[model samples]
Target chain A: MFLQSDTPVQLVSSQSSSVLGEETIVLQYEAGMYYELNEMGGFIWSLLQASKGMTVGQIRQKLLDEFEVDAVVCQQELTQFLDDLLREKLIEATAPAP
Target chain B: GASPKKVYKTPRLKTLGSVK
Candidate 1:
């Protein structure tokens, strides 16, 4: 599913994560699967862990500020990452407040 | 002022399989 820029996302309750060096390891309890996130992926995961309902746009801006990547590339990559998380049931997205 | 040279890497999420 395509996540809107303003949509808020939070980690699913059935998982636990650990940050080891530059990588973040997440275990989905229900699926009994382990996900390894690289440096950039770990950075995004850390953001979500720190804040319970951060928006996609907020994440994109944080990436832009922390890295030298182009804005378009950042948005595209972030959306893809979040989409993967959503598909794996590691995270859930909420509709924007009306 | 010079900014950090780190470019955003395409975030990778590797599934390592169930631990059971």
Candidate 2:
């Protein structure tokens, strides 16, 4: 599924995560699958764990604020990361409220 | 003035196999 900039995303309830040194380890209970996320990926995961979740644009902006990266590159990398989580059912994205 | 160094590494997600 193509995710728009405003789409909201959150971690799925079935998944759990823990910090291991610089990385985050995520476990998908139903599938008994383990996924490893690098430091940047862990930061994004924490944002999604927020009660209100976060939009793709919001995440991109946060990365820009916290790191020195080109806007276009940030968006591209963020999109790919989120897409991977979505594909693995680690996260779910919702349409922005109309 | 020089800009801060770019610390951004492309975010990655890798599957580490299943518990079962």
Candidate 3:
């Protein structure tokens, strides 16, 4: 099901997203400003950018298809990564319904 | 701040603080 969060996290596609090595990246937009994301961040960001939108489960699925990691491991890692992105304001994730 | 290059072309990789 689609979610609706006031501060839902989504990438700014109009902005230039570039990969810099394995775990480094630069997102440039809104007046030459750049945001640097590390490797894990880049991976998550890459999926988001490619699909435009993916749920927590979808992200985990992608990880499963790409890497040889287990589902539980991927889920935990993806969930944590999503949480960090939200906490850091990197992404706008709607809070669970009260 | 010194000054912008007369002709801006090269990308300046300045160290960014922990904003992200």
Candidate 4:
């Protein structure tokens, strides 16, 4: 399923991350995997780290305020970016309780 | 003031080599 606005997400605690210049490097300890994120991806990583389980929509709104992009386009890109993170197990997403 | 559309470049994510 695609990540929706309300999907709550956070960085995996078992992982370690460091930033060098514009790139962010994340190491998943248990899996022994390394994932590198570019400048914009770094920005998104910071946002999620700052607020645990922040919804996808909230993240998009923050990005819209900081960057100039159409809402639709921003959402689309964010969805794909988050999906990649999920695939790598770098972040976890869950639905808010009803 | 005219605001220019921000050029959004897709962020690159790569394996960048890995360790077992």
Best by DockQ: 1
Per-residue lDDT over A32-89 for candidate 1, one digit per residue giving the tens place of the 0 to 100 score: 8999999999999989999999999999989888888999988888999999999999
Clashing pairs in 4: none
lDDT score for candidate 4 against the true structure? 0.85
Model 2, which residues run further than 4 Å from truth? Answer: B1-6
**How close is each model in CA RMSD to the real structure?**
1.4, 2.1, 14.1, 2.2
Q: Which should have the higher lDDT, number 3 or number 4? A: 4
Candidate 3 all-Cα RMSD: 14.1
| A22-62 per-residue lDDT for model 4 (tens digits) | 89998988789998899889899999889998999899998
lDDT tens digits by residue: candidate 3, A1-98: 23332223465544555676754445443334456666656777877777644566666665666566766666666666666555444455544435
- Candidate 1, superposed: residue stretches over 4 Å from native: B1-5
The 10-residue segment with the lowest total lDDT in model 4 chain A:
A89-98
Name model 4 segments beyond 4 Å from true.
Answer: B1-7
**Order of candidate numbers by TM-score, starting with the best:** 1, 2, 4, 3
Go through the candidates in order and give each one's C-alpha lDDT.
Answer: 0.91, 0.90, 0.53, 0.85
Question: Best TM-score goes to which candidate?
Answer: 1
Give per-residue CA lDDT, model 2, range A7-55, as digits (tens).
9888889999999999999999988999999999998888888646688
Error of 2 at A52 (Å): 3.0
